[model samples]
Target chain A: MRLEEKFKKLKQEKKKAFISYVPFGFPEINMTGDICLTLQEAGVDAIELGIPFSDPLADGPIIQKATNWALDKGANVDLFFEEFSKFNKKLKIPIVIMSYYNPILQFGLKNFFKQMKSLDISAIIIVDLPLEESQPYIKEARKWNIDNISFITPTTSRLRVKKIIKYARGFIYYVSVTGITGPRDLSYSQLSKHIKNIKQNTEVPICVGFGIHNSNQVYRINKFSDGVIVGSEIVRFIENNYCEKNFLNKLKTHTKNIISR
Target chain B: MKIPNDKGYYGEFGGKFIPETLSACLEELEIAYAKAKKNKNFVNDVNFYLKEYAGRPTLLYSAKNLSKVLGLNIYLKREDLLHTGAHKINNALGQVFLAKFMGKKRIIAETGAGQHGVAVATVSSLLGFKCDIYMGAEDVKRQSMNVFRMKILGANVIPVVTGAKTLKDACNEAFRDWVTNVRDSYYLLGSVVGPHPYPMMVRDFQAVIGKESRTQILKKEKKLPDYLVACVGGGSNAMGLFHFFFNDTRVKFIGVEAAGFGLNSLNSASLSIGKPGVFQGANSYILQDKYGQIKNAHSIAPGLDYPGVGPEHSFYKKIKRAQYVSVNDKQAVAGFNLLSKTEGIIPALESAHAIGYLKELAKKQKNSLVVVCLSGRGDKDLDIVRNYNGIKL
Candidate 1:
């Protein structure tokens, strides 16, 4: 399904979206497919699969650790697509590839988007490709009928937010804090206001991420925004429990438990 | 009419390829800096600090002996004699003034060789602002003395033990810090790389080197030098000297990049062996494998150990305005020793790369008037040199 369709269905059901971001090839390169299949089974509305790069400046220690693990295991763009192709057909929910811009540029943007189209991937989030340099990405993504997600942070001014959402494609990634992705004490009162301010400008769904680590945060954040993205928390879960035999079942229960909240 | 138009693109190279969190901050910073540039008080304050606190108009001495020996008209732009013993202080003092003008009480910077770190720490101390420096953990070990000096200047030296464990990682850590604290702090970038405003802003700050050298050379030689040379890491010092001479069609610019072992080995010669790719928030020539994952850059000089060069340097290289050449570890060391003996001035390993390329330059261009930007002193690199040459004393 397209990302818009997923959000529309969730809106019709009066349900908030539960999004999970897992670094590709975390435990093992081949294990990415299983994780995606598991995430979809675990009641995730959408999955944000990370393309690990050498330098992830926007990430905290947790994601950085995962990036290192993935790269050490010889995970590259081609390997990610090749390995994930097995489960791409099995995935029912929309999947977005989260990558820094260089890999996509190096992989050739036209070819990358074509590969994504082939895999039925819904959207792409280039973390570093800001509004200023996004014209090429936007034009190419549009050609591929791919929704290129744009990011807005709490630090973004109201005017800039309006300007960014003007070009926002599928959904706007609302970084809940003024920092990189990590678990931190976030004031929902302030965040809710930020979300409300964004909602006033665009009717597009806003998914909040960064500094959200627990179900409690997912619950609270879901109250204000259309979706909640759990990254470091889920990555931490996988990092700690991937060795266990019943990890997938536990992940389903954990994800189900979080969603029901 | 100029490069890096309002949007900050040096041809197709530079843009604000940063995170959304830093968008407003950088935009505000760019606007604020623009206003500050026009405001006489701000400009005067920066000039005052540059002259009074940091030291400016550093002598441009003609290296008669070295010039005679090499059969080239060689002159040295003595930035090593600046207050912080490197051209870095010029930018540090200027940016801190801008930080102060913008009401930011805290300053953050990333450093590799510790020259920029020490310069920033010293300026931050003099200006009474809270300062934090992010340096690679490996750099902290290699440049322990400069780290100690930074601590003595009351700047918190934070060691980054991330990717490559060197300058590249330090840059990553610093960007992380800046993104995290974009609310109340200012990121005083030490080089002419990074997202939009930084490359242009740093170039403007360090343009003092180019300005002073150009003025001094005209007064002394009554004509422009045929060649302007400086070592390129993130390419600040080279840009510092090269920016002034950019339009001087007759003057050739040579930027020396560090080749760790050799051109074929693990090296920091991104301009030589790398492809155009985005790293550190700007699109530039970066050392990367076929997968586009940034390759680890190595050099005997920690400062030159970077995977990417500045976007402006990329633009210059593309336009054939400046010539970039690589000098290996042995060549740089030899250059360091030669300059020490011939000119009686010990040059920083980073600066020595320029000298290393001089012999190569002289062989091609005969009796050419050359101006080499002696970007820093060798005090910060004594240990590495002593260890390399097996000098126990």
Candidate 2:
């Protein structure tokens, strides 16, 4: 199903969407599929798979370490697709790839999106691609029925937000802080006001991410946002517990604890 | 002569490909720069420093001995005589002036060769602003003298030990710092390679090089030089020397890149072998793998040991406005010794790359007037040169 359709279905069911992010080939090459399956079982609405690049400017220390580890283990775009094809066959929820733009450009934009269509990938989030430079890639991604997600930050101006939302698809990612993804305190009053301002401009569901760690934070964000994205916290958990025998159980428990709120 | 379009692109190169968190900061800087460009006081303040403090209209010397040897009338645009010993001071003072105008109290910069670091430190000290410089640990070791100079100038020098331990990592660390302190700090970007207004602003400040050269060459030789040559690290020096002459189709421009071992090796000559990719902020020719992983770049000159060039240089290369060539470490060292012995001047390893190309240019064109931008002095590179020659010190 399309990512937009899934959001609509969640709205009808009166449940807030819970999205989880993990770097592809992290911990090990073949473990990502099992981790996604565990996240799905724990009530994640969607999965955002990170395609590791050499320079991930948008990420903090945790995500940077994970990506470096993945790259060191010989993870490449071709290798990611080879493993993801098998994972997609058994997955029911939508999968979105979060990558820097250079990777997609180097992989050939047309070929990358064509393969995404064939693999049933639902959307993509290019962290560094601003609205001004996204026209050509957005045009190609639309041809494959793949949504090109747009990012809005706390520092974004209202007029600029309107321009961004005009081209936004899938959903809007509201970065809760003016810094890289890591644990931090949230200001709900300001966040709520910002979301309300954005809501007046677009009809798409807005999901807040960055600095979100626990169920309390997720519950707080869900009060104003349509969904919550948990990234560095989950990757931090995987980094700490990947060697444990009951890694899946720990991951499942962690996911359930966050989503149950 | 042609500027980037409204969206900050130079023919499919140069855009603000940064994160959304820094977008507003870039917009603020762009607006500030636009306002400053029109403000008479701001213009006067920048020019005052360039003349009285940094020493503008630096001499254009005729290298008679080297000219005779090369069989060409070679002139040196003496950027080395500028305060802080390089052309980096032009951009450093300009950005610091802008930062002060915007009421920013603290300033940050990233450096590869430490020349830019020292330049920024010098300005921040003179202006009484809090300054912090990020440099790779490897560079701190190689450029220990510059590190001391920066500290003595009252700037904090932070050694970055991440991601190949070079200029690339230093820039990444600086970006992280900027995002955290975006409210009170100004990122005094050293070269013409960052997002939006930086490439344009740096070029504007450094264009004094070409402006003076144009007038000086006319006064001395009664005509425009047949060729203009400078070394390309992030291409600031070359851009400074080439910006005014860009519209003069009769004057040829040449930018030399540092090929550590050779062009085929893991060299830093991005304009020669790299593919177009977005890095640090701008779209430029970057050395990266097929999977878009940035590659490690090697060069004997710390300043030119970067994996990417300025976006304007990439644009110039694409349009064939400028020709880029590379010289290996051996050739650069040879050029360094030859210039020191013949002209009684020691050139930086980075500038030596341009000098190394003169032999080839002299062979191709005889009796032509060639202007070479002596970008910096070699004092900072003395230890490296000494060590390479088996000197204990």
- Cα lDDT of all candidates, in order? 0.91, 0.92
Give candidate 1 misplaced runs (Cα > 4 Å).
none
Candidate 1 structure quality by residue, lDDT tens digits, B290-384? 88899999999998999999999999999999889999999999999999999899999999999988999999998999999999999989999
Off by over 4 Å in 2: none
Which digits, one per residue and each the tens of the lDDT, describe model 1 over residues A1-261?
888999999999999998999999898998888888888988999999999989998999999999999999999999988988888878889999999988889999999999999999969999998888899888999999999998989888888888899889888899988888878999999999989989988988999999887778888888889998889988988899999989998888777777774
For residues A1-261, write the lDDT of model 2, one tens digit per residue. Answer: 578888999999998889999999998999999999999888899999999988888788999889999999988899999999887877888899999988888999999998888999979999988887788998998888789999998889998999999988989999998788888899999999999999998999999999999999999989989999999999999999989999999999988998875
lDDT of 2 by residue, B173-244 (tens): 899888877889999998889788889999998999999999999999899999999999899999999999
lDDT of 2 at A127: 91
Worst 10 residues of 1 chain A by lDDT: A252-261
Among these predictions, the greatest lDDT belongs to: 2
Q: Lowest-lDDT window of 10 residues in candidate 1 chain B?
A: B48-57
Provide the RMSD of all predictions against the true structure, rounded to 1 decimal: 1.1, 1.5
